[model samples]
Target: MSGLDNVIAAETRLSEVDGANGRLVICGHSLDDLAGNVPYEDVLALLLPDLLGPNPQAIRADLGQARVVAFRQLAHLDAELAALPVTEALRALMARLPDGEDRETALLQIAAPAVFVPALVRRQAGQGAIAPDPARAHAADMLAMLTGADPGAEAVRALDTYLVTVSDHGLNASTFTARVVASTRAGYASAVVAALGALKGPLHGGAPGPVLDMLDAIGTPANAADWIDAALVRGERLMGFGHRVYRVRDPRADALKGALRRLGAAGGMDAGRLALAEAIERDALTALRARKPDRVLETNVEFFTALLLEALGFPRDAFTGVFAAGRVGGWVAHAHEQIETGRLIRPQSRYVGPQPAGRAA
Candidate 1:
């Protein structure tokens, strides 16, 4: 009963995570099919066919305008946002959006992270936020806004792959949070703010940034095995080496690793870091299997996510916010689905505490 391990909470047509098979299906396409092949805006359309329609070009234009709207809405709050953590700033700004289930509100909800996250990043560093260009693609605009420069084609593709790879997974903790709020008839902004709160937990979206810390501690490829062995002996949880759902290596890991490789091939990334990470992954898998034969511990998406985002110039603290930028589309779609068809999500809990004097045991 604890952790809702086998609980069937909600029915969704959005996406599924087959942990046993290490497969991820989004809409009707496999993750492998969509990640590198399909753009992020196309994935948004796939998730929100009824709301966003099937035309990716139109969705891109609408989403671009949504980004501008979100940017303008948050422009005056720059100083306040700079003082909060990135995820908290995102949640705070999301709360300020007008609450409604209307199409425009949903688009704004989805665009909130794309605009607010980078703006907060800039504000935190004592720089003015860059405005979103209504002409560029969503992922490109996120990169450009963060760095205040035009992002390269390969960097844009790398970011798009990250976004597409993470767009949705069935009933994740944060997605479930969004659905719960949506089922209460709350609008997209409210639901997405709730989801952002859930994602701030260490067990969920917060795990990715620590992966860079792990890599830093390891220092070199030659130190990987010994460092991993010592960390395992010390009972320290290795960031990015395991997942709660997957019994096999996470499918997103491969997708991101492929993106990182492509970025390096384009001379946008340092080859040394990639080599060190691969060595660490090989050693970690071997050590995990040897140390815990009864459990399945394999490389998950966070390992390569840290590398890809770092290569794309995101600081470690911004990892989860970037994750939200990709996942907001799925959150909005899931919220819409719950609003359209689902009832209020209120499950009963058994009373296990000491009963009052008059209460039955």
Candidate 2:
């Protein structure tokens, strides 16, 4: 009754969030079995099996072309929209995409964040927006647009891992918001915009950026234990240490931590930074165990989500915007599925207001 805890609001086939067991399955595959092993292009196609035709490779190429189209069509609005926050600006830009629940429209939704987020970041920094090249892969194009330079192979792999790991996660707050709007028969754009609004809240998509901030403040391995203890004493919640759903270590955290190590091995990231993060994770876990005792309080996705994105060249503030870029595919697919097979996501509530007076009893 309270905020629908333990409530099953709607049915889904896109992904499963097994919070009790710390597992995430996207379209019948474990997240670890998918993330870096499979390309994001194929992941989205699998996520929307009905929407995509039989050719997976062609679907991948079409997604590339869609990114080019989105970039060219919406790149002109930078000055008019730069004042909004990055995620808001991204929502505004994507809302302008050609409307429908057709395949092209779905592709546009997947392509929108990859196109607009970098443009917004560059425009905000007084840099010109980089044009998308349809020949490159999705994650590579995004890194290029954000930085105006091609990333090394290692960096591209790191980002691809992050994207696929986060592509979908059961019916999260934002995904549910998208489903609610979609159930009303609103178009996919409306649903995605609704999802974006939900994702902007700190309790959801906002923690990754702050995780990097915490690491920066801690600065080095020597400072990890003392800094964490003092921060906990002052009652500050560590940004990436806990998750609402997971009672065990978040599976995505381990996935991204492995990606971070690979990036480090390939010389794409500094070894010292990775070492500092390890030290911090160790300290944070130990302190949390001593203080809370009963709770698991292990690292969640955001801990290494920050490390992976930072290594791949995303600015801290633009983290959520980038997250939407990855997640919008799931939103698009979920909305379309809800349209075909789901009912309106309306729910009734128990009355808590003051009751009318019983007159003349």
Candidate 3:
């Protein structure tokens, strides 16, 4: 099969996706333990142990400084970057970093999107880019950079949950892409850029924005079941209703949902919107179970991702770039791991074409 099902790719100490049980483990921590409970800098320390150093506080400060540096480095490109799509602009900014295996390059790769995604958001809106606050938490700094104001504590916490939840997720398509490039001895920046290309594909990082579309089409709680049923009847996918890896439910979904609830509790999100999303999730789950009982279709991360990012004031078009801001740490960590312990990830394929001269058949 072209899917490479059951294939054992590179081994690492980064994260594991247990599809059968619907669990995610990062480094030594479970998804439940990390998301919303820990800061993103703590997760980065777990992923990039060698580079982030031993102190969690220092890692936070260094990453904050890195964002400042990345913003300065890409200042010259802001006019041009604002013209491109956010993800492409992010990739372009990432491409500008000096390629190296050193801590400086890795920090830039991690920080570039944090800086650039917000800059691009503001610049595209004809507003000036806000400079990074070197002392702020990574997620808070991102929110601050986006709005040019200190964000609320709850908003910062919610964004931190999101970044930590997606910081790593096993050998996913983009992480695998990063590994493939890293196996060739490519530096962190190159691997990260390549990974961003993989993530830009619709199948991988494009689902979240569409989840909002699905919700918008459903219109209200009363319309969810019929809309979902119709989509399924038409052989159309119900976005955010299923996952390729998780058999039960995506753990990240619950994590994000929790964050959304917390944000709603803090008066950061519209309560009616939250209720609408929850109703749709319940309806989608019931409809999927009835239509495809043999298949395990459950609420995935993209469902709540759409709601949460919307509440955070991000447009649907920039969803994937926000995802990259979270996943970049994993890409860099995987690249570093590949360089330290893995061989070139060259896979073989069986040929199924015509034999030459009938020598063998």
Q: State which candidate, 1 or 2, has the greater lDDT.
A: 1
Write down the TM-score of every candidate.
Answer: 0.98, 0.96, 0.97
Q: State each model's CA lDDT, in order.
A: 0.91, 0.87, 0.90
RMSD of 2: 1.5
> 72-158, model 1: which lDDT tens digit per residue?
876569565679888887788888899999889988888878888888888888888899997999999999999998988999999
lDDT of 3 by residue, 1-361 (tens): 6587788987889999999999999998899998999888899899988887757799988988898788887558746666999888888878888998999989888988988888888888888888888999899999998888889999999999999999999888999999999999889989999999999999999889988888788888998888888888999988887888899999999999999999999999999899999999998889889989999999999889999999998888889999999999999999999999999988888898888895964
Which of the two, 2 or 3, has more lDDT?
3
> Which stretches of candidate 3 lie above 4 Å from their native place?
78-80, 358-361
Leading candidate by TM-score? 1
Let me know the TM-score candidate 3 reaches against the reference structure: 0.97
| lDDT of model 2 at position 357 | 94
Model 1 pairs in collision: none
- Which residue pairs clash within candidate 3? none
Error of 3 at 2 (Å): 3.2
